[model samples]
Target chain A: MTAAAADKPKKLVIIDYSGELEKTWATMILASTAGAMEMETTVFVTFWGLQTFVKDKKRITGENWMQKMMSFMQRPGASHRKLSKMNFMGMGPWMMFKLAKKYNVAKPKDLLEMAMAMGVQFLPCQMTMDMFGLKREDLIEGMGEPVGAATALQLMTEADSTLFI
Target chain B: MANLDIKLKVDASGLSCPLPILKATQGIKTVESGELVEVIATDPGSVKDFDAWAKATGNALVEQDSADGKFRFVLRRK
Candidate 1:
């Protein structure tokens, strides 16, 4: 590796496509850890993954009936996300939260805040926002301006490491 | 113990994964360069994590030890 390259902080880019609680938790963990490690990190959230950044934790989002139905089934927001497996009618997430607390692990909300505090960037997908009929106000505070797939791709090209979660 | 002057102490016991390292990173920066930062962590993974962190961040790990389920590390700021 070049000396200049070694001296510069490593850049990491992550693409989040799933809104499942487990995946989002993992993504947050990595992002925050990378920030702690002094890596320049960015997370691009798209499709269902964007739900994790919604402000309305329990309410269904979207304008059209179909979009509303989808939101109703899955809900929107970080706290409302379900496990991809072993959900067990919501008991699984409850149990997971208990375990995380017992282990002194930061919760999803805290992790998101910590990542932001550590300078990790969160970019929501513009195409996904329009397709889901979501406005910028619908997202959580401190989100980066909406950008398309090309922006994410450009970031990936420049990043030293890239992850699709 | 008395000879090694520690400029800062980070207590990360009961925390998980990245938190220990995260707190250490923040703590180390508060001290002047060449000063020592001491960290106590309960996470078993922190041993290797700190090793990699020291190498990656250019901090020097001066001491590492474990006792009574806690891991201790002394790092000299770069």
Candidate 2:
């Protein structure tokens, strides 16, 4: 590799704070695509976006009654994510998934799995977790750890290719 | 089909954008460096996507052709 090319980092950082189904799919698609392109990719999930990391598809437990009720309404995990528009109370996400399947396009969860297997960094937001009363067990397995603002700052500032979605 | 030796072949026909490229990359990695991999895709976007992916990943897009409504791309791993 050329010295200049080797020195330059081909990293893409994504701040995924959107909770909508379409938005989540877009983030996963981009993350997987970038990883395929040989770019080091990181996805920082915060606020509603943390739902992507929440394994709500599996049986979930809450710390307390309020947490349980909240988890019931706002389950964390990719499978139960909702759509931002045309949700029709939930039909939108299902339709989108069906369409993706019809076209042989990978689903959001599959793309996310592929990206994770490819070594894309997946981080939860510590402060946001504290605010939401979510614990580590509420998230998906294999996500290394929760990160703070400073880590996001460094990654965002250092990366020439960064996306806010 | 030409008599070119392909180390790997990925059929991405009927798939959409990003899937084609993603599958192509997966196939590329299975072969040794400098080996060739061919991707068969029906997505119209594969033409430009493969070209750009080749340039970005430092691979060689040795041949790209569309025949019988299928887009074929042969790439050499860098």
Candidate 3:
């Protein structure tokens, strides 16, 4: 290998906090697609995203009407939005999930399963666990230890690519 | 009949979005070049999702048909 190639990092770290199924799937696709190209991948789920990793959590619900309304309002035309604006209620999240079902998109649980099958590292956020009063046992099987955001950030810093979804 | 001779069917019904793509990805991996994969789905999002998947993965979608809340996708693996 060339000297420059030898110095390059082959790892990717993704910090997923969107909590929406579509966003989560998008993040997974990016990471897994990268991994398919031979990059090592690590996904750190924090805050609301951590709920999806919990064994008993069936779905990530909008906390309130305002949050739900704001989610819809923030799509495309919201003044304060910075990241890619998505329509969760309209053609975004629900649609993505529906198409996924029709096209045999991997189930949320199956995505996790495929991640494991593909050797993707799954890390749960410790602070989120504390905030939610959840224990390690509450998480699905095959998850790594609960880690702090700092540690996750460090991993991201060292990775070739880092994404916050 | 000759033009549509190659037929491949994938039952993505009851599955979710990325799962269909994921399954299609796996299914395509086993198919020879120029073979067609027909995916049956109920999700409305499958329309755009399959289009995007075909674009991203270098697969050619020969046909897409929808009726009665079900979608049929004919993809030619490149």
**What is the per-residue lDDT of model 2 for residues A41-155, given as tens digits with 9 covering 90 to 100?**
8998888788777775644445677756776786667887888778887798788888888888788888988888778888999988887677887788778689998999899
Q: lDDT tens string, model 3, A1-165?
A: 223333443788888787655566577676555443335788998876775665543232234565445434433111111223566345555565567566655645556666665578888888876665556766678878888978897898889778888
Best by DockQ: 2
lDDT of 3 at A122: 81
Best lDDT among the predictions, by candidate number: 1
Query: For all the predictions, what are the DockQ values?
Result: 0.49, 0.55, 0.15
Error of 2 at A59 (Å): 5.2
lDDT of 2 at A67: 59
Listed for every candidate in order, the interface RMSD values in angstroms are 4.0, 2.9, 8.5
Error of 3 at A9 (Å): 6.5
Alpha-carbon TM-score of each model against the true structure: 0.91, 0.92, 0.53
Candidate 2 at residue A74, lDDT?
Answer: 64
**Residue ranges of candidate 1 with Cα displaced over 4 Å:** A1-6, A56-58
Better of 2 and 3 by DockQ: 2
Q: What's the lDDT for candidate 3?
A: 0.66
Question: Which parts of model 3 have CA positions greater than 4 angstroms off?
Answer: A1-9, A56-96, B1-78
